[model samples]
Target: MILAETLLFALALIDCGAILFLLIYYIITLSDLECDYLNAQECCEKLNYWLLPKYIAHSFITFLLLFHGQILLFMLNLPMFIWTTFEYFTVPRGNLGAYDPTEINNRGQLKKHLRDVMIYIGYYLIFFFIYLYSFILALLKGDPIRRGSDDDIVTEI
Candidate 1:
């Protein structure tokens, strides 16, 4: 249990860290005028480069959770893994014409918007369920096991 807890904690930390890094990168990219000036092909290449590490980190977290023998964590991780994988596949990449951003009124733009909405819904639903489950587990189990804690103690004076 201790080992599993430690591994989960580490995975959680990695996931959280990767999330922060991605957020920061996203903010930086959005803040830059150079990004807007870049051609569609260049932008896609740059974006993919930024996304690759985040994909790896998310995958690692999911793998850890799946193998850790905890039912709740495993359930929580599976959807997240799938969502990220979906995003990776759906995301526009390289110099392909598929990636060119059209006007909001265009049919392609509407399709993209719908896809984004569905992905957001899926991600959020999974996240909410994971939190609810974890909260219930915490209530039932008191707290997760920690390393180097005294599980058994005897004192005599």
Candidate 2:
């Protein structure tokens, strides 16, 4: 069905946009942590190794779709990308000290720590769901998320 195909195509575009948005944000956030907080440049290398390729792939898919005249879907990504970029520039960085007795003793500091951790987790989840839902929608639309996923489709349903 054309509707299903459109949904599949849209999911792919959103997945691409989501990753691009989060990849930029995460890289900046982690880099800030490594540079200004941790002072350990090597700390985020593994994450970069794992994510850089995916980011590239997402970019490629989004751009290709855009070039092919998917204007609305591509346009939808602009606000997210802009917001993420804005957040990267505006968010503050702090020292990454571990296990300070004063921090635990102060309830306010504890709350702040909790809030920051929750926010970081939230950022991860936001894009994670985009990736997840894209795959799910793809499968539901009878499209393959990957090469091996094709065989799992049931047409009679």
Question: What TM-scores do the predictions have?
Answer: 0.53, 0.33
Q: How accurate is candidate 2 locally (lDDT)?
A: 0.49
Candidates in order have lDDT scores of 0.53, 0.49
Q: Which stretches of candidate 1 lie over 4 Å from their true place?
A: 1-4, 31-41, 90-157
What tens digits encode model 1's per-residue C-alpha lDDT throughout 52-149? 67667767766766566666766766776786678667745543332333333246553454455455445545554554555455445643444344
Q: What is the lDDT of residue 142 in candidate 2?
A: 55
Query: Can you write out model 2's per-residue Cα lDDT over 14-105, one digit (the tens) per residue?
Result: 65566546546545545454346543333334333434454355455556546656567556555544543453344344422232332333
Candidate 2 residue runs with Cα over 4 Å from true position:
1-42, 78-157
Please report how far candidate 2 places residue 72 from its true position, in Å.
1.2
True-structure RMSD, every candidate: 7.1, 10.9
